[model samples]
Target: MLLKKERLNDILTDMAKQARVYVPVSPDANDGGGVGKSGKAKMTRFELYSPGTAPNFDLVNTTMPPKDMLFPQTQKMYRYGFDTEGNAYIDIIHDSDEVVIFGMRSCDARSIECMDDVFLSMGYDDEFYKQRREKLATVAIGCASVAETCFCDSMGLDPNAAPGADVQLSPGVDGQSYVVVAQSEKGQALVASWQPYLEDSTAETTQVSCALKVNGDGLKDKLEQMFDHPIWEQLSKKCLTCGTCTYVCPTCHCFDISQENKMKDGERFRCWDSCMFSAYSEMAGNHNPRPTKMPRVRQRFMHKLCFFEDRYGKTLCVGCGRCVEKCPVALDITMLIDDIQAADLSKAEEVA
Candidate 1:
């Protein structure tokens, strides 16, 4: 099913009439905590909220990842109580309403699918992630222009490729139309429901939208032998150990679990955590697995490029480049990959 570029929000508002619709909303003064110095104007910062105005579809990328829809920063699992008989009762807090995540990028939507391998079918199953995953539908939009920090190409992601979107919208060469394709059964259902907005796809539209492409097949093997290369040290020098890179990363899934208590009743909450922090993996005895910034840096890349590939047959990174722009030290992952590509690793020991 193909939808017109002009009717995007009309379709969204229609969906919202029946279910909850979440689009990327830019920051207002209320988003970043308090008012500015004048105390009158709301300071605008980057935040993801419900769309107050219609979305700007031609924009490159969003400030935040679409992870919150899949793995919320903080979610309540259940509430427990004891009656007079001391019998424990628990109430599950589940997402009952259907949610449509409109105007998502292919990279961001694909990242959610990558995360599903870990949280859904792996050794452990998270009821929260599973429930939300089942309740949500993703509508992916193609990138019209690439950012300076974007390296979706290096990660073998196409700016126009739709890996995990239920429905993908590719802008036509005419610049006024779109090519819509449904990649899944759910996507097909969605397109069928929005039949009024869709039209038949044209071969011309498909060819024009995906002109940008990259090959990342040898990336994992390339990173393996280049682990000890000098690029690691050079890149680490610019890093501030700030967690922004992972925090804004669409596919980075490291989180910390904590318990909040109130008298006899305590609630367990999980929030976003980063691997860059020195205390991230600190044990009860204060022993840290990653003792230095270099190791921490190494851990992030290795996990994204190596460990994730080893486990799921895909690289963890979607190459959205949120880290490149958000980092205080200007630690760019694309440049690091380019440096890795330049290294002569014929003599280095291979890593699996």
Candidate 2:
């Protein structure tokens, strides 16, 4: 099946009529946004699609990941209050809507899978996250172009494939159409509804690959041995702890819960948090486990490369490179991986 490039908006519009469709949009067509056939990184973002939305399919990756569709930055878990008659009751805020994410790249899709492991797997489930996830459907548009920092392919992902996506749209070599394939039952229904905008023809998918490469093989083992190595100290010196990496990351899922109270009413909510902050480790006695930069930095990387994999059997990082592009101090995860792989663990162990 093929979806003509020109009819993308119409197809998206059709989907929007039934479900809330989110698309990768160029904030502005003339603002050096990722708008044309060949993608540019000026700025691309995911947003709710509506009439006149100029969906930029060529964007290699959005500055922001679509993980927010499932896990929002701030969510209201429930509302509690005492009635005028002094009756106490709690109102569970069940916010769920039929949503479809269109034009997410493979890495972003895999990030959702990582989130699924944390929120929906491991013998427990989060009702708030599950509610949103159950109602959401993914429509991934495979990458036809790669950003300079993209290393998703190197991190065990096909630039042209999305894990667990409902529908997959691989761009044509000529960038004029997309070869569409249904990857799930939900995808079948989605494709069926897109029949009017699709053509009963075939098109060759673009075989594009990321030029950036790194050897992630045995990275977890290498990181485990280098826990006490001086590399972390050296690396921590440059970190500003602004938490930009965690915010832009497609797979980072740390959060903190709190509440808002009025005279007789209150709302409990959870908001995104970052391990990079010193306050994250602060406890009742004011003793911070990861009080220093080195430990905090070490914790972040170790969790991403080793600890999560130990528990989930998958790397926490999907290698979307949002952190690499957005980090203020030029602290790059790929470089850290390279340094770890090249570190002399034998000598470090001897010193330890």
Best by lDDT: 2
Model 2's lDDT to the true fold? 0.88
**Model 1 misplacement above 4 A:** 28-52, 81-87, 199-203, 206-217, 226-231, 344-352
lDDT of each: 0.73, 0.88
Clash pairs detected, candidate 1:
none
Encode model 1's per-residue lDDT on 1-352: one tens digit a residue: 4566777766776777766777765444234433564343331222233434546565567777878877877877766666568777766777887877877777787798888988987678888888888988888877767776677766767778677888887877677777778888988888888888777656345331232334456778887776676556666777788888887888988888777766545667678888999989798899998888888898898888778898899999888878877888777676666666667776344421
Query: What TM-score would each prediction reach against the true structure?
Result: 0.85, 0.95
Q: Which numbered prediction scores highest in TM-score against the true structure? A: 2
Model 2: lowest-lDDT 10 consecutive positions: 29-38
Model 2, residue 231: distance off in Å is 1.1
